[model samples]
Target: MVNWNSLRDELEQAKQEGRYRPLTVWESRSGTWMTLNGRRLLQMSSNNYLGLTDHPDLKEAAIRAIEQYGVGSGSVRTITGTLDIHDRLEQELAQFKGTEAALVFQSGFTTNQGVLSSILGPDDVVISDELNHASIIDGIRLTKAHRKIFAHKDMDQLEAVLKESAGFKKRVVVTDGVFSMDGDIAPLPNIVELAEKYDAFVYVDDAHASGVLGKNGKGSTDHFGLHGRVHIQVGTLSKAVGAVGGYVACGQVLKDYLIHKARPFLFSTSQTPAVAATCLAAIQVLKQSDELIKKLWANASYFRSKVQELGFDTGGSETPIVPVIVGDPAKTMRFSDLLLEEGIFAQGIVYPTVAMDKGRVRFIVTAGHTQEDLDFALNALERAGKQLGLLG
Candidate 1:
């Protein structure tokens, strides 16, 4: 038998470094408030941007799908699992994104992994933003393409890299629509311009921006009014859509190529009927109105301003995903614990998720949060910040 003692040592070291995260168990649905350890805590760490998780239409749709199609998709999409609902979801996604075609994947991470690995070749080159998500990093790693990194949203460096990589047969530029940790929007317009000048294609992972930005939540491309300029757009159904799965919106040819060449799509089972239905309902909900998006922005602005007034360091935050930067990992975790004691549940993010000195407590305000909820959490944050000497 293989010895597992080394694993325990590694875990112990992680714990000592304050980076060992234990799973949090919640006894209730993911809403503005959730039950944890028999106590109600204001949930500020969820990515339910539009609060569609608890929407009546989504819930009803999910139930109807379960009744009609059962609980699971029994096979991979390329096999027997391509249900009518899945096709409908893809069609809806393509229409929503204004793309010629779209392909679904198991998760946002896998979507990146499969699409990048499949599309990029050894002779090609991929230029990535330094602060891009781990999924993007892993996807680029899986590709045999020559990789180049530019500073986060640095247009000059991107242009420089593109100029330097002009010799490659093909060049692709990839970036996250919204930097998850800092909550800063990517300079996509500049990127698009640069890609055009360099004869490179653009790929944007819009996981955080999918249902949180643009007109009627059409994502970053729509927000920036660069619809057809971007070559590839990947987004998650799990975040603002309040469902599970991921997709790549691109031209029909690329979609067809990925369908055959993307290993994850071929190997993994399709999303359940209920998930597809829920996603469809979410799209409908977004299309019908922007009430939830407006409400979310209002709450986020209110909460972020209050936190900043309390002297918390919110690093480059331009959206609902706000981070209270704390330099020490241990102190960041302590700050999270302090907030929890006061009935809030903002999660502490440490190294690996962020840089060592950039540890923070991340708060994701949602549309479901009332003014009262915002005030209550702000009070809790103030108290916690004072206790930790994080506020004046």
Candidate 2:
């Protein structure tokens, strides 16, 4: 038998270093509050920004879809799995994004990986933002293209990199519409200008910004008014849309290319009819209303102001994601635990997620959170920070 002692030791080491992340089960819907291990806690770390995950319309649509289409797609998209609802969702997605066409993938990560890996060859080059999501990094790694990383949202550095790639067959500049960890918006307009000057295509991963920015939540491209300028736009349905899947909104030719060439889309089974229906319902809601988006920003602003007033460091946050830097991993974990004890459910973010010296407790405010909820969370956070010697 293989010795498992080394594995045990490694786990123990991870535990000691406060990097062993154990899962927490939410007993209720991931909305304003959730039940964890029988305790009701104010939710602060969920990505359900618009609270559409449990919306009545979304639930009803899912149920209706189940009655009509059954449960699974049974086969990959390339075969017989592509359902009529999937095409409808793609049409709605393209209409919402103002793109010529859109193609959905199994997930946001797979969308980035598949598109990058399929399109770029060894002769091409990808100039990516240093602080882009890990999915983007992994996708770039899968491609044989020459890769160059520029400083986070630094246009000058990007220009320098693009200049160096002049001899490459094709150059693609990729960046996140919103930096997830630090909650900072990328300077997309500037990046687009530089890309134009350098003769490179601009690709933006608008995962976090999908339902959190732009008019009617069209995402970063719409937020920056760079609609037709960006070559490829990627977003997630799981975040604000509160559904499962990712999509690439581009021209018809690129969508066709991905349909034929992208391994993830071709190999993985299509999204269930229920998911497609749920996403469709969610988008319908977004197109009809902006109330949730306004509420989310209001809650975020209130929470951010309160936290900052408490002498906490909220680094570069312009969105609902507010991170309080605690520096040490153990201390950040302790801070998170104390907040949990106070009935808040924010999680500690440490190394591998962020840098060791940048360990923090990240809170994601949502549309479901009321001003009263924000105040309650702020008070709890202040008390917890004081108990942990994190605040004056």
Question: Which candidate leads the pack in lDDT?
Answer: 1
Each prediction's number of clashing residue pairs? 0, 0
Overall local distance difference test of candidate 2: 0.94
Let me know the TM-score candidate 2 reaches against the reference structure: 0.98
- Which consecutive 10 residues in model 2 have the weakest lDDT in total? 21-30
lDDT of each: 0.94, 0.94
Q: What is the lDDT, from 0 to 100, of the residue 201 in candidate 1? A: 97
Poorly placed runs, candidate 1 (over 4 Å): none
Write one digit per residue (lDDT tens) for candidate 1, span 147-166: 99999888999999999998
Least accurate 10 contiguous residues by lDDT in model 1: 383-392
**Clashing residue pairs found in predicted model 2:** none
**Residue 146 deviation, candidate 1, in Å?**
0.7
Displacement of the residue 223 alpha carbon in candidate 1, Å: 0.1
